[model samples]
Target chain A: MIPAPYLLYLGHSDDPLGIKTSRGLAHFVPASCVGEFRHDDCPLTVGMPRMTLAEGKAAGAQTLVLGIANPGGSMGASLVADALAAIRLGMHVAAGLHHRLRDEPELVRAAAEAGVRLFDVRDPPPSLPVGNGLPRAGRRLLTVGTDCSVGKMYAAIAIERGLRARGHAADFRATGQTGILIAGEGIAVDAVVADFISGAVEVLAPARHDDGWDVIEGQGSLFHPSFAGVSTGLLHGAQPHALVLCHEIDRPHLRGLPHARVPELAECIDANLRIARLTSPDARFVGVCLNTSRLPEGAAGRHCAEIAAQLGLPTTDPVRFGVAPIVEEIERCFASSTPITTVSA
Target chain B: MIPAPYLLYLGHSDDPLGIKTSRGLAHFVPASCVGEFRHDDCPLTVGMPRMTLAEGKAAGAQTLVLGIANPGGSMGASLVADALAAIRLGMHVAAGLHHRLRDEPELVRAAAEAGVRLFDVRDPPPSLPVGNGLPRAGRRLLTVGTDCSVGKMYAAIAIERGLRARGHAADFRATGQTGILIAGEGIAVDAVVADFISGAVEVLAPARHDDGWDVIEGQGSLFHPSFAGVSTGLLHGAQPHALVLCHEIDRPHLRGLPHARVPELAECIDANLRIARLTSPDARFVGVCLNTSRLPEGAAGRHCAEIAAQLGLPTTDPVRFGVAPIVEEIERCFASSTPITTVSA
Candidate 1:
């Protein structure tokens, strides 16, 4: 079992992109990976500290999360050493990297000796039956993104919180480990057995709750070269009536894969709608959820405005600006189809 | 490892549908399941005999395959008894039913005592990574169906055989156990990790074989409630340049679900094209592979003609009329784009 309130580890990284994502995960989702931020040499602009294992323990770090996600997803010699060190330091280590700490013989031996757990977020599940989501009809809202790790989960949680604040009977459906931890329960869509990928969703968002909406966390992207299939299975399985499209403005290209470019905001919107409409014909693009934290002052607002104007949908960085605009559109959609009372985020 | 040339067992049954498919697999693909056919009450028209385990051994049965597959896929008490008796006789038992023979406690105990093996065809694979098949340039042809068990694998094998007969360089990519056993090597697509469903196809039909065509066997159905996700993953993963829509003339409804009606042939064709074009833009519907095995007298020929005239595509039951018409379109599609030279079935 994973003991929460983690120690975020930003190990020595040569790659620029890996550094950005690791920092982003820590800076944005601070509550999930709390306690002391450990790094070898983080930038001055970031404002994180370089801490030793003893220093981390003094700060009450229950678990040390490997903050560095490799650029090419290659499992190498260096990453394993860092995780091994963390295990030896009497910390339950959590990693979201492609290189699983559980797979390393030395790391497993150390973890067992220390009586600590190693949580690999990317591990696919063991068994699943092929799903029948077509027959089930319940309200679900999903977040789609232009690239991986562009704040789909964060946006979903924010919208769910906003709706909940207004006293609505809405729930957030987590599709990944991080979201699952935050929400307390969810199916890891990517980890499910291939035949049961969509079935996993069917099981998660059962058709029983007719009065409330299920704000489902989405995975990957339609344009991502390595994980688009997960995106498709999720789009079909969730069968969302309304979709919030998330985009990372600073990302010029797909993460890791240099050859693949992120689809244009318009194209991403259209493609997701087309795929979702295959199963849910009434599927509509409700709003745009922007991740413009990396952009300079006044730029994030301007970017949201321009895209919102062009697409004729309300847009905002759900984290900074509040998810009221996106949540409003969803509330509007649900209001017309069903007799629902109360305003949402 | 699967032992070759199985002893086909048609257990006691009243279901006409189960009998036909069993006989068809044995008749069409004799090499995979090699020994004498066994049944308790063999009909005269079918031309097969009821044989005891001792008789089956005398006839050189290496493995006993539970030939009767229920429409609802239930493995009853009697079927388990037959399999246990076969195991005691020192024959490896193989079943394709939903009620996994390997899951039964008594069967497991009996198998251990007798030194035998059990194979469950519907078991999904261990773990799989997501696929990126969009970059591949290999010429691939997939057989999609209106519903499950509608001759997709049969059609793919026939087309590959015909292409090979005409001295064309082509290979059949298997996605299921029967096809895997037929080809002697293949990852079960349905059993693969959900995130890696499409990825499995990418590994199977890689871009290296740019010169030759890959006749890919399809699974489940885009319209089947229990398995549409498999259909979506395979379609996106295969990235086929040309797709053949397979249909059975006598299927009144989807396999087990009576509520869900089979989609019209035209609608099925359109839906598949829309889904496939998401990844492979140049993908086209090359032909219609009909399964008119149950059609009486001259009705099968008449039905083929009507569909061929309406859709304006080459249509035929690959088993009955040979896969010449379907192969003609695939060859034509390939000749214009690639340097492949040959006439095929």
Candidate 2:
């Protein structure tokens, strides 16, 4: 596991969407974030205290988290230098990029000399079994999306919190890199061998005896041609009892592919449910989590209401508003026979 | 490419199915087979002349092909010793197993000392792109299956030969180890990173200016929980104009999974066509290829006729009879405007 109290590195990124790792970490686990680091030209921040390597070390930061993602997941020469500096200061370095940190000889040497660790979060654990598609005990709610970066992770994290607050047993199961960072552990299902995509997910969220809910963070959309295979495997592996359909209301097309249009909400839900039934026959839709952050507050509320009325499912923006409606829908749909006594966290 | 004039290594295998690689090589490229090497007590053979490493080298063998697969693809000590003996004789060693010959220090040292290569057919090439799902120029036919080991590769290879004989341009694109060994080169789609399965396949069968038919070997069944993801990704990546559904008639259940039943021919055809259309809008089934080896000649013929009438599609065993019927159906369905003169291979 990556050390807590991270000094998040923003690098030279200016795009707000590109630095979602830092944003997610600060938003979800702000108590564990010590400070932020960035170049002088880097105009982005996750709203943490600015600090140098020495300053972050003095502030009790145990790890330097490279929290920015560039095109192709490549690490520039300057970013390597920054990581090296962090290593020299005896701080462990962690990144969730397609390019692995262990591949950098300089970083490897410096980290070894300084007795610090390097964590490449995108790497899957070795020797994952092929998926068996067996019925596993435990209730699961997976957040599926109409496209990538549609707030499935955020909705999952929020749903987990909401479930626990209502005296329900729940755990957030991360499936991607950013979710892995926030949850402290998860397999990057997309990086796994093609044969083991579903199997990896099966390992990630195994059978639980407590009948607790595994709030799984989903990846790409089923309609997304570039990543639909990974999405399908994860769906089948999850065998989710309940699904929360997540959609960014303003998405004109699928992410990156201009030729491929976003699938309709009904189409997305139907496809996900149909494929999910291969593993979990009782799978059903729990709610609709809309990413209405692009809309005005009044319009967002009206949009949620309209969708809720249209589909007869609870709808809300898990980030902008809250996941209370979705959580209530989950409770109503899959009410437990032996309810647990409420205990405040 | 692996060196031709291969000394096929049976490696103490007793199961006929376990020695399919050797059998495939011996069947498809008999001229390249120098001789076979196996333990004296081993009863399995691809029906080649028996020889030791020294005798095989004298017989002009350039490589020792590990043509046996044990459970979990593990390399036993005896197998390593046999491989080392070949390396010492200045011969390259090739294997399609999950375990790599390069992973054995003794084999690596011997190969390096002898200036010989170690070929791992399951390892994919680096830097594969994500599939764009854009229309590529080519007429393609993919052989999909109702379950694993249902003659997808054999059908693909046979179809390529039949198409070429009919003066149609065709190439066999392999997607598995045995097929890769037969084809001399291919990307094992299952071994690829989960996100790049389709991308690797797209690279494997790129746009052909000649409008040739790329007969891509298919992988796992869509109904099989262990590997449907690989199968789906391959179907999308191939974007075939025509699909050939391959199935074994007598199989009671999905391979290795006792709980899962094999999908019906119609269900398999429907799923493959529906998924293939995501990339190739005009994707349609041309014929069905059945593995009728388990049935008697008369029963196989009756079975083929019954299914042919029931589905209104040409059905035949590519191995038992030939792929001529399926190739004829393909020509009838997608006839080229300008016919080229047939050239004998």
Candidate 3:
């Protein structure tokens, strides 16, 4: 779990990935949202953007996590200004973004003078050799999304929790921001160089003599218009035996681009299997984790059922329900003589 | 044409994209290969490595292009030593590899002292806004490959020449080191950040009021086991109105990787279209450019005929024969209301 004292400065926006637009961060990590800072030029959104940097400190905020995953991975100028103010108020700043806050000379100097740690979640791992896509002895299950921000990380985390509940030794390997914050380590797969993406995954999920299951958080989607490259790289890199398909039932189009429609669930599954088999010849789709928050009242459970019937697979809202089905499938498939793809040719 | 004064330097290895495994450099720009340089420890190959840095300078070598694209990018220490020596000899060093020589302090200092430039072909362009993938008025024909180093640049150059002969305005857009050297300006698509790959293409092929066809040199292959990401980004980034598929008949497997076989021509074409159409809905494959240098002596022309018969498309070795067939297809398709994918749509 992530540490409590952190100001999620939305800077006049309501759509930070972890926080609910209406609830103002009530759900995910309780009491973690101490303050909501805003730029003067922008109107307040969601819960009133009333808390100042000083008030956040008074409220026991220890650090500021740039909670939003902005497109193009850059923090805009207004957010940078708010971040600087937070650093001046003696708050450690952390940004899990493509553009590093540490890269800015002024922010670097201010953070240094204020004695606050500026953590960039996307710091690339040291150079790695190309991934041979060899299978690991330990069972590795990766959660790949239908698109970015479709709850791949959340699904992986939930699946891991379910595995642990069943008295299994399970490890969660994060490949993005929120996961890194919760798990305290792992490379940002999208930020990695093109050639080294699979190599980085190989490093992240090394073969364990224990053969304990490792749930790998995936990034991007093979059908995503802009980010499919990252998706393909991660899929090919993680030569996993089982995969959890994640989707937001309400997403009509790719997150940012209107031109890119989300491929049909069947199409996405076929595309992923075709690519995944390039490395893992027998990669199997374990289950489907749907984010149904955007659906109208009472539509969540029905959406899950419809998908379950349609794909003939276990389907549920990992957050509203739980990942028990997915976990059971993984353990059963990996622990038994299930004909999983092995690394040795 | 690539500038005359630059010397081609393949350190230790005789392979630099193309040539007989033994004869280091031949066929592309005559007398441009001053000599091969090898560190004392590096055993000589492809005719004894005989050129010293001093000898290269005396042979009128104004620049040293790191001709080989090494796996995982970084040059060996011996090559860096050779580069530093050339820098000291007042020769500008240019590397087309993903590893930037500009990152090295010793070479930086040596180049500064010698007052010579360090040209990194893979340097990212000035950051640009995300591409909207709108239909541009100007016709853009991109040369995509079945694998890297399959003469995409050569095809683009040849097509541009043929288009000019037919009294049309044609421009060749280079997207790699060799093409950049030939065209004098273009981004190395592989070196670019993932988000910016398409943006760079948008910049490279901006809308022109004049109806000119921009012939773009593509990078990597969509089916390439290692660099599919680069390939995907380049294909979708260029959003070319028309595509020319470049293939080498003798590439039994993807470069470097032994198990990843090249897809069949039809499969490759379909896969590229599926990805490319995500950005440009109606993008079409105009022709094929085959590099058959590795084939038996007189078999090149016959193979081209067989492929042309099979695909029912114009096919030729643009370097050996010409790109006239490809130019004709582009003009036939795009010069009129061909129901092409519009940028604005």
Ignoring the other chain, what TM-score does chain B have in each prediction? 0.87, 0.93, 0.87
Count of clashing pairs, candidate 3: 5
Write model 2 residue lDDT over B237-339, tens digit each, in one string. 8888999999998798887678888988998888787777778889999899999988999999999999999899999988888988888788778766133
Error of 2 at B233 (Å): 1.4
**lDDT, candidate 3, at A291:** 90
**DockQ of all candidates, in order?**
0.36, 0.63, 0.40
**What digit string (tens of lDDT, one per residue) describes model 1 on residues A230-299?**
6777877787888999988868678756656788989988878877765687899889899887987498
Candidate 2 docking band = medium
For residues A285-324, write the lDDT of model 2, one tens digit per residue: 9899999978999999999999999888999998888999
- Cα error, candidate 1, residue A7 (Å): 1.9
True-vs-predicted CA distance for residue A85, candidate 3, Å = 1.8
How do the residues B150-186 of candidate 1 rate in per-residue lDDT, one tens digit apiece? 8888888888888777666788998876676566556
True contacts kept of each: 0.43, 0.64, 0.25
What's chain A's TM-score in each predicted model? 0.86, 0.94, 0.88
Candidate order by decreasing TM-score? 2, 3, 1
Better of 1 and 2 by DockQ: 2
Stretches of model 1 off by over 4 angstroms after superposition: A12-49, A66-75, A95-106, A120-129, A134-137, A223-225, A336-345, B9-25, B31-48, B52-54, B66-84, B94-130, B208-210, B223-226, B336-345
Of all native A–B interface contacts, model 1 reproduces a fraction of: 0.43
In terms of docking quality, how is candidate 1 classified? Answer: acceptable
Query: Each prediction's Cα RMSD?
Result: 4.4, 2.9, 5.2
